[model samples]
Target chain A: MQYSNTIAILGANSEIGELIANKIAGNYPLLLVDQSEEKLYQLKQLVTEHHPKAQIELAVCSKDASWEADTIIIAANEAAEQASIASKIVEVTTCKTVIQIKKAHLDSATLHPMLPYSKFIAVDWANTTAIVEGKDENSLSITGEIVHMCGLKPLFKKSLI
Target chain B: MFEVFFSQVKDKVLLSEAEQKLVKTFFSPKKIRKRQYLLQEGNICRHLAFVEKGLLRSYNVDDKGIEHMIHFAWEGWWMADMLSFLSIEPSTYHIDAIEDSELLLISRPDFEEMLLKVPVMERYFRILFQNNIISKERRLISSISNSAEEKFIHLSATNPELIKRIPQQLVASYLGITPETLSRIKNKLNKNVPNT
Candidate 1:
């Protein structure tokens, strides 16, 4: 699927979320969504301070943010929280790219069943090279592009999920 | 349409006919009207544009909406927000056509692919980038240390065509001087010149 210019980060307050946001802030418009409004605003301030031209919007509702964004990034630390966010935005994310930043130990296939309509790509954001895995080559390549845009080398791994 | 580009490349490095054809395939030719914007300040600069004909200028808008000229691309010269293009960031400067222009544009991916496919072009880019840096350094020094009249004289000596082709107001902005000062300098210089 062709990705749009706007990207939504579900857990904008998380470390990984902020890191990814800061890296891609200049390239794409961002819709930052998180439960904590204060943390989301703080992230916006930090990103805008570094990238003065960065276009950032904050949202407390995951569904509304995901609905507006063509690409959704689930940066929630807990697998349950990621799954919960996916479930809330499932209807809005049909045929869209949903990238989940998962831990090395986490099962990559866990979110696929929840958002069957969306193209899912699991990213293991390692220190240097990020391992990107998806069911199809299209989504894998798209995810790899985004990973590269975030200043990480993407190593594509065939999904064993 | 690509004759100018091919000539510029040949001046730096010899290219085989086959390699030239390969390089040609990477760029798309575009025509822009005078005053048309090639890039806006808030947008990412996706392409590196080489001027085939006419002129283009890059400038920054201050908080008070005054424009500060940055650079100009004449025939055979290349233009882009280098920082935005390489880093995939939003551009701080806007690039616009000063005259109706024909340009050859290559996106970042194609630019990389072309370099890998035609490695000789790498030397060409190295020289181009080196010269660009040197020019920027000189401009920076000139802006900081040179007197207004000295700056005008230096610009006339280096780029006589710019003084003739561009408007007095824009030339003054590029030299970081007011248009009135530029007019005064021109009048003073013309008075000192011996009659033919």
Candidate 2:
């Protein structure tokens, strides 16, 4: 089976997830997944509003939900939920670095026993958003490009860890 | 007790005898009983407390009134809401003693004065902050990435002593799991793995 250059954004209904999707839209074909189909529809409209030509599909993160995409980004409601959804994502794809983009988190380490791959990055997306608000366009673009890179490349192949 | 504190500083930046004395002059020692709060939510954090003996924990009660732990500071660790202490804003967290503890606290003014007087301390503080950032980053990843059982296993493998010392409830909070979840994890471990 040939997987296209499709990027899946889990929890796409989230505010941070939307921002992330909006940033990367038009640049690539997208698959947006969340807890609710209704919310994903709203986000699809929003993404279309910004990138009229961008190809975007949708899925909800239910037990039966699966993505036929190359990469998946998890933007869960909370850390606990993030971990749960991540393990589920791993069950379907050997996709690298399921980046958990969180709004605010105190501190965290690695998932050793669970999916013991070094293909995970716990990003403080709030700080990245702050950069966007601060109008540091260059820095924001660099970060945006880096996140895009994560989507473009399988995490395991580009093992720089 | 202050030996631990001095060693921590000296490890980072070698202080002259006189500069060391100046550093000591800025701090005043205090004792806290177990379960006594050193700083509370809505109160401006005044001093950066350097733990000399015993243990302390920092946490916040969320909207559901569930306590979510921020950290556990033992000997040689510093406890303070850096935002509150620096900005003079109301603290979002509470710091309390987990064991009868001794601390050497320096107010913001004194801490600043020490940094100014003994400029070498700048190196030490910079190292301290860097380590804190690294630790905090690790914690953020671990909290969001690992399962309750995985977290317990990670802690048990890395810092078994911490598990032995801390109560189950607080350990659950630190691991970002419920107390019942923690008990379940321990039960699962007991059954699956041989007790080491």
Which regions of candidate 1 deviate over 4 angstroms?
A: A1-161
TM-score, each model? 0.56, 0.53
- Tens digit per residue, CA lDDT, model 1, B1-196: 7789989989989999999867776665555658868889888998898998999999999999999998899899999999999999888999999998877777787789889999998999999999899988988898899999999998899889989988889999999889999999999999999999
Structural RMSD, model 1: 13.4
What lDDT tens digits, residue by residue, belong to model 2 across residues A68-143? 4434566666667666776675444322334556455534333323433313444455432321111223323434
For model 1, what is the error of residue A77's alpha carbon versus the real structure, in angstroms, after optimal superposition? 54
Q: Per-model C-alpha lDDT, please?
A: 0.84, 0.69
What value does the lDDT take at residue B66 in candidate 1?
96
Error of 1 at A32 (Å): 39
Candidate 2 per-residue lDDT over residues B24-61, each given as its tens digit: 66665555568767888988887898988889998999
Per-model tally of clashing residue pairs: 0, 9
Interface RMSD for model 2 amounts to: 24.7
